[model samples]
Target chain A: MRETPSLIVRYVARRAVPFIQLYALYVLGHGEDGPGGGFQGGVIFASSFVLLALAYGWGQGRKHVPEKLFDLLAPAGCLLYAGIGFVALLVGGAFLQYEAFVGEGADHATKHHAHHFGLIGIELGVMLTVTASMVILFFEMSRPDEEGAFGDGASQEDVEALHDGSAATEEAPDA
Target chain B: MEVLILAILVGLAVAAVRARDLMASVAILGGYSLMMALLWCQMNALDVGFTEAAVGAGISTVLMLAALGRIGRREVGPTRAPLLRLPLLTMQQRLRRARHLSRQHHRSSAWGAILVCVLVGGALLYGTRDIPQVGASDSPANRAGSLAEYYVTKAPEEVGPANMVTSVLGDYRGYDTMGETVVIFTAALCVLMLLRQARVRRGDERDA
Candidate 1:
């Protein structure tokens, strides 16, 4: 409701986002060795953006992560994922076959090496897609339009209609 | 420990359901997700627990708050229900009004719904008895030569990932993960389209 949250919230959120993002990357990169992976990491990463948005207001948050960048990254991750699969196919193996990334050595070390890198690449792709998608979702959903509940263009009747005609009266004096 | 978490989860569920304020309901739902995440960790599914904590508790709560910002937080209901008016009435009048209000307000249907939910829940609880206990080696899933057995035995050797869960998810079950990613992408795009279209329409109306 307020243009920006209180100073404490803004400061805490600003300070926390970088650490949250770093943790998300740790979860993503450590997926193969630990208990987290792309989805969890990506959500954690997006939560940083969401936290910033809540603290700084949507306009300032949008500036941090622009629409054009979100659009580019959203599809890019999915493409990267699919591209890995296609590359496996091109290497003359089944779809999504990580073993194909390495040539036909059939040795244990080569297979293991290929699978390791392949999983990392795939998780990275997944992380990118998930992160971009979630950030955009928060941005789009929270972006105040002219007809929103507290938007400037909303008439008294429209606001009343949205809030069952009683709640707006309770908060009107504050606004 | 699991029992404690599950109890808290049930309490949170009831609190979320019975909350009069939508904002309170969202907060209660977040608590429920956090409890569920703890339960998942207790069950040794750390990835799922992490996801439940992040997506269920963190992201969804923020999204709901954003949505509440757009639409008012109050649930759409009668501002002045008969129950609230009872303070002015005498004892007998209050009793009569309470009975009348209950019948008028589909109280019987609510009771029926509660009854149905109890029956369905009991059935589900009964059905769980037939399920194999956790990590039961004789179970169909863990039986020798089954796909699970193969994955458990060979995942590290085959995929070179110490975490079998990631190896399975990223490689063996790669298609499913890809589909999930696409679904998320599509869902975001859908929301974007709907919200953008509404904004555009409003802008056009202002221009007109």
Candidate 2:
């Protein structure tokens, strides 16, 4: 494949990403009333970045959402989830009891609101983690081997040796 | 509707298996997922349908494409021999064809895989005989005082989400979701360590 796809592909990808992201947000927020939630939303969101990678290059996609951002967002989502659970526990309720986000004396309506908010918060956490992980996987897996330090040791001779089995070793046998 | 989608799914599956080009196989698999998502929608499992569309069809296709970019797309193997021969072949030609057929690799393994698939599919179909049809009120899980009955009846009032799946997943099964989130995060961390460690070692070698 070419390093950069054709102009038509790039133009369409650039135009489509924002709409895809907006729809992902809709899916994430509208889960209670509709057919999507964190996992689906996050995958859709990540796909926008994947589109960018396909049209441009892996380096270009990584430029938009860098590895540094991945390191931050990945853990931040898990922390948010654990923090919500601990908040309920610290207030003398079950670990993830959503009603505990409100005071013990709060009325049913307030507790209902709290529970709704808590579910949204959890979903947000899921979206962040999933989105980061997917982008990370894409960038890592599609990375050009030439740019990697791990490939430095793989010389032409090493490849030939593996294929032809004809290179005689100079080193002595193991002691 | 279900039958149409299922037929398309089976066709896509066979096409994916028979395709020699890895890229075409990935595309066919994506179509299979699309048909599967439609099947889920037909069964009234909208959330599962959404997941199948996004994860199975969309993200997985992109991921496989990325992997394909890393590895060459053409599969390295012996070219398939033609399945037909003229009925009036000479004795020498017949012997040569027989020798060629014997030289083909993986024919036995292919038969073994087909046998395994048939046995497993038959066993699963046989096992489904005991299960009730969808939405049967008297089914084990749907009967009075059962957990599903309790969740369907009381979850909305108690958990405050009109969507029972949301309420159940986010509240009743909060720990499970949390654990899943942690597991995903852990996977990212492991990838980071494995990929980054090599770069860090290279840096140390540079310093030396």
Number of the top TM-score candidate? 1
lDDT of 1 by residue, A1-175 (tens): 3457789989999999999999999999899898899899999998898888878877788889988888888888888889899999999988889899787877999888888788888788888889999998888888876455534433443455557435533544542
CA error at residue B36 for candidate 1, angstroms: 0.3
Query: How accurately is candidate 2 docked according to DockQ?
Result: 0.31
lDDT for model 1 comes to 0.83
Give Cα distance to truth, residue B162, candidate 2, Å. 2.3
Looking at candidate 1, what TM-score does chain B attain?
0.85
Which residue pairs in model 1 clash with each other? Answer: none
Off by over 4 Å in 2: A147-175, B81-103, B106-118, B199-208
Tens-digit lDDT string for candidate 2 (A20-94):
999999999988877888878888999999899878876777789878888899888888888888988998788
**Whole-model lDDT per candidate:** 0.83, 0.80
Q: Candidate 2 chain B — worst ten consecutive residues by lDDT sum? A: B79-88
